[model samples]
Target: MGWLAAGADHEVRLDAGRVVARNRQGRVLRSVPKAVRETEAYLELRQLHEWLVRHETACREQVEQWLVRSLPVPTALIVEVWADEAWRAPLRDLVVMPVDDAGRWDTDRAGLLRDADVDKGLGVVDLDGETGRLTSTQIVLPHPVRLPDLTDLREFATDLGVKQGTRQLFREVWTRPDDADARRRELTRYAAAHYRELRHLQARATAAGYRVQGGTATVKIWEDGVPVVASVWIGEGDPAWETETGPLGFTDPAGGPVRPDDVGPVAWSEGMRMAAALHAGRVIAEDEESA
Candidate 1:
């Protein structure tokens, strides 16, 4: 009863009346199928992935439990730490994955373990459905992982910046068609405004001699192709902004500028600016009494 955990270039094959699996590195892993259903090959791969995740979870939970009992700290302190984690940690990172299913391991099922602050690691696992003989290989132990305590100001600040930046950028760059509902239309307009502003800022900054990195530019258009400035990206040395530059036909090695196809809803402030400019040309009638 052997099993294999393999990857993209590797697969389990029924060879010589036995299951033999190879990884991308040409290494063979020992594995046995827990269940085999005749289905599309893709579905089979998915099933194996599911099994791998389950085994990895079981093993990681066991490790955490062992840590609680084995640590030399007082039981009260351990309990407090556990309670704190239970309440605060979103526990999202606890979900398992297959980082390098290609690596050969002597186990029935295998995957990867990833946590917020630690490097992802390989997991080797085994399972027995009938008598519940679930086991794991205790080889290549992973580095210790610690989840961020939300109260940590530094981590909180970093998270805040990422969320705010992503939300603002996404809304500004991608827009919806007129057939979209009011909610969708509003979102497109918001994104358009953001794009236009970013472009304007990038141009101004670059012209002033600051290097703008990963910038985007956007313009709004009517369904019939009338152009208006919708939004723009303005910053120095931010690589993540690269994705939002698509509104321009091509991203500038130095920056991006919006074109007619990028149009969406205009911000009220933008409209007001146009009105102000228009009024600037008008002459006011003089009051006879004051004259």
Candidate 2:
């Protein structure tokens, strides 16, 4: 059952990617049906994504720079990062769906969320006794990442840039003289747990001839002139988790990693690749008869 479920999930995700790619191609085809080709569609999608990122950031920079001082630094940063993770987690399970469904899987607008066979990954919930409706709450399969809000001292110093206050607060909060040994142990444990995931990603990337920097904690992998994807293993106190540049979110009140499983598939088989596979004129609906 697990095997079938996993494979089905992969196929579903792949199908969803194909659908997105097809829609993208269709847009170009509509505009210039006589001239648009597969190559053009692929190039257009790639360029469009690049343009979107640039425009989004460009428009936000003025606001971000203006609010830099008054903004709730740590909390705002953590929430932004957490939101990113939340968005990606769903697609991770979806990737396995496509592999499971083979050539008969279908997907709707909500992407993998709409797949009927998604119950396992969705995690079972008890039906309400009165209404007979299943619980709407869904727990993340991999432990959710948590982010913590900064204390008043940390926040003031961070936002105000009071040099002495910031230095003193850091010493008192992050590096208390009395608990140095205990803090080391906690930091060590966090690093150890993140090592396995980092190593797996590094190995795959290295075998693909990519140069990897940083270890199991936070890594930056680059394929020379092609592209770079940085997989940062965020921790509760990691400074990197406190900025809009990251893709994580922290719970209100106390910020922390919302979900560790937010890291979706390390593979990039979505969008164009999925569409290319389907464009060979193959149908992708799920088939249960074979099993």
Candidate 3:
């Protein structure tokens, strides 16, 4: 914003989301003068900064929602929002795959998002650090569990010093064991986590962006055109009372149990991720003795 006369001696303008002042001699001050801070220009800039902060947060949450659901976003939609800093910030450097007309993931062609141009398509940097563009009509930011060569990808990301605005490559994932009794083992794996209070467990789930209803912390995943819900029961009794978390389980849209062996990889990993997050905190109640 252009500098505006603040007082007889000072002129102020919005600079890099901050209201900065310059003396009459045209030297930038280290900080806004005490008197200038109360000026209308400074107040306006502060309000703008607050709005931008909210905008950035909202954009990031939307992008995270897309990643969790593994949605195939339209390329045009990406291009439309690519210009906005709030939207671009969360999208930049996220590993993306082009989706063919038949909706199959071009797994062999994954790249870190870098730019979007209407005529040139989405520009990206691939695993080999080669700059390229994918002209596919749609693309997906796959969940880590769905990604191939994840170990190598993490190494490559680290080598490049890449830091994603949203968790993707670095997101923790769980691989459901494949065995004769995998179902039972998976069910018991993260179960019976003792919490000092039922409310504490519930609070953790909610704070981690999962929905808690009917004593369960829940997240839904859409895999292979089917919806699966994963939930961990925290308990329904008195909120203040101590409790133990129940087994993490998955169910179909119709509410039928989905055995761990039958659960899709993305769903299994995300479910376990949510379960682990809620199970992480444990405290011994004063009434109980340590093992």
Candidate 4:
């Protein structure tokens, strides 16, 4: 972006989401002069940087939502957003597979996204280390949990030396166990985690993108196209007081308890993921440390 004049001697422009200033001699300044900072050009650049930061975050979150939902994304949409760096960054190198009209994935057509061209097609690098363009109009970026031979894909990704902007290939996954009793306890495996303070736990949950309600840290997932809410009981009362987390559980849209068997693969994985993230922040007490 061209530098905008700040008064007569100073000029300012955005540099990697920051407002930077330069002298009239065209020498870059180490710091934005205090006087120039108050100029309209500096303030506008600062405001633009803030909006860009928010746009980047929103773009990444939207891509994550697509991965979690396994939604079919049209190439046209990709083409439209490809020019925007905020959207391009998160969508880069993600595994994508062509989807049939009936919403079925063609595993053989799976590849790592590289480029999107409106006139040509979606460009990708397949599993065998071949680069090509997928002419399919719509494609699904399958979640790691749904991919076949996930171990092979991980090894392949490692070989390609490609880093995915969105968490997919290397993301942790969990599957519902076959035994009924095991399924029942699947959601509760991370229970009894300890935190020094309720506020700390609440803050952790919020930072992890989970909602902290009155007495629970919750995450809602759309499994099988139905809303499934998973919650972990974080004791209520004074936020600064010490607290312990309770068992994780899931409920339907109506707030009715969802049966363990009824919880689908995606819901089970996501519910466990939420609990595990919170549990990771748990503090081991003195006595427990000795034990």
- Residues 156-185, model 2: lDDT tens digits: 435644343111223212211234454234
RMSD each, Å: 23.7, 23.4, 3.8, 1.5
The whole-model C-alpha lDDT of candidate 4 against the native structure comes to 0.88
Q: Give lDDT: candidate 3, residue 245.
A: 83
Q: Candidate 2 at 278: error in angstroms? A: 34
Candidates 2 and 3, the one with greater TM-score = 3
Against the reference, the lDDT scores of all candidates come to: 0.31, 0.25, 0.87, 0.88
lDDT of 4 at 27: 96
In model 4, what is the error at residue 158, expressed in angstroms? Answer: 0.9
Best-to-worst ranking by TM-score: 4, 3, 2, 1
Pick the winner on lDDT between candidates 1 and 4.
4
lDDT of 3 at 37: 85
Using TM-score as the measure, the top candidate is: 4
Largest lDDT belongs to which candidate? 4
For residues 45-94, what per-residue lDDT tens digits would candidate 1 score against the true structure?
55666665566556445443332122122222222333333311322122
Q: Which stretches of candidate 2 lie over 4 Å from their true place?
A: 1-34, 37-49, 57-178, 194-199, 203-291
What are the models' TM-scores? Answer: 0.17, 0.21, 0.82, 0.95
Question: Candidate 3's residue-wise lDDT over 53-159, tens digit each?
Answer: 89988999889878877878999999999999899989999999999888899988899999999999999999899999999999999888878889989998999
Backbone clash numbers for all candidates listed: 23, 46, 0, 0
